[model samples]
Target: MAPETPAEPEPMPAPAVILVQPQLAENVGTTARAMHNCGLGDLRLVEPREDWLGDKAVAAASGADAVLRAARAYPTTAAAVADLHRVLATTARRRDMVKPLTTPRQAAQTLGGVIAAGHRAGVLFGPERAGLGNDDVALADAIIEVPLNPAYRSLNLAQAVLLVGYEWFQAHGGPFDMAPPASDSPPATQADLDNLHHHLFRELEDCGFLRSEEKRPGMKRNIRNIFQRAGLSVQEVRTLHGIVKELRHGRR
Candidate 1:
């Protein structure tokens, strides 16, 4: 048999990482190094306290010059993510303001979905001394809080960026191995899952499983979560549909 052709490399999902009022050049360099490590190329500085491209940063970048060279500077957080469709703000402290909060994993998953849908996404990291101010947080669509010791929750600029960047890489960087998996079964698509949910819900409603008006919302949510967590395959979804139909017919 002839040799198999090499597969093309998966395109890196570029999410712009904005550093707001960064205090240290070394931290900026280290952050760039972390960003490059996780396949993130777009770096933005908003009113940096130190020279973003100074020797301290370059030295700390440890050979991540490409990221440093291509970095951009902005006057404000709003200006940095103006073109992006979704922006997430990183903060350690609990805010009293009402806003959607997500973990790093969730944010990365959301970013993957946003990028897949051809929309721009970005993340904002505040200065070393103080995290994103209320005004900066207000500009973001969602807030990302890394779980830490409640008594002393503090993360340096590079550490926070590294954690987020690492998650994004894991979510969208594709399989590390070049070889395909042994299983040929395709994962069920969202539409397939939705159709299955609808079919199951209809059957449940017909059987008076959703008769409780007050509990219907919670019941539906629980059922959806159960199936979504399964990460069912296409054949598995079909099997589930068959089971639901059989049960309904037997009840009739």
Candidate 2:
């Protein structure tokens, strides 16, 4: 009998690189090139100011036209991450939230584990100038802060994405040999969490729980951070929805 060739290993599950409100097409192109270099192809843009797949972007992407051509644009950060099971936001400065913090390498390891378990993950990069806002950061399950020089920590959009992407590429297959952690239920998607947020917020508003316009934003963010850190499962989210609905019905 002829010897049979071994089946090839499956390609690593690459996380989506999401750019929020990116300002320049060239930056988007360069970002695409960087992603391509790391074997990543999912490029998502939220409210980009420039045409990401335009001539300038294409020229800047060089031969990475595949990433640019397949890029998806979203209207909001929430919409961009709605389908993701795990999300990490890249930030330059410390925030007031209590989410888990990790370096690019650490985040890459975590993302690799998540993907190995058959869940989708993504990293969010904010605008070129301001980076991620508190609102954008709150949506993430964790924060990725590159431990750069404290004296002058300044990186452009593509540079930041490239740093993380490189780490992710390096760490991709490291987790595949190990067994994924067991779970009773699948993790909640960002869309499920968004629905829970909106549902809970509506009930809170109806019950006059968020009457203070000055504090409402902060309060909402705190609530989001709490749930985000909980790592709620799909069943847990549904139970919470039921709890919220029951509470609202009791009042009526």
lDDT scores for all predictions?
Answer: 0.91, 0.93
Could you tell me how far off, in angstroms, the CA of residue 163 lies in candidate 1 after the best superposition? 0.6
lDDT string for model 1 (1-252, tens) is 999999998696678999999989999999999999999999999998888788999999999978988998999888998999999999998788899999989999999889889999999999998789999999998999988788887988888999999988888866778665655678899999999999999999998999999999999989999999998999999999999999889665
Cα TM-score per model = 0.66, 0.66
Which residue pairs in candidate 2 collide? none
lDDT of 2 by residue, 1-252 (tens): 989999898787799999999999999999999999888999999999999879999999999989999999999999999999999999999999999999999999899889989999999999999999999999999999999999988999889988999998778734544654677888999999999999999999999999999999999999999998998999999999999999889666
Worst 10 residues of 2 by lDDT: 173-182
Best by lDDT: 2
Cα TM-score of candidate 1:
0.66
Best by TM-score: 1
Candidate 1 stretches greater than 4 Å from native: 1-10, 178-252
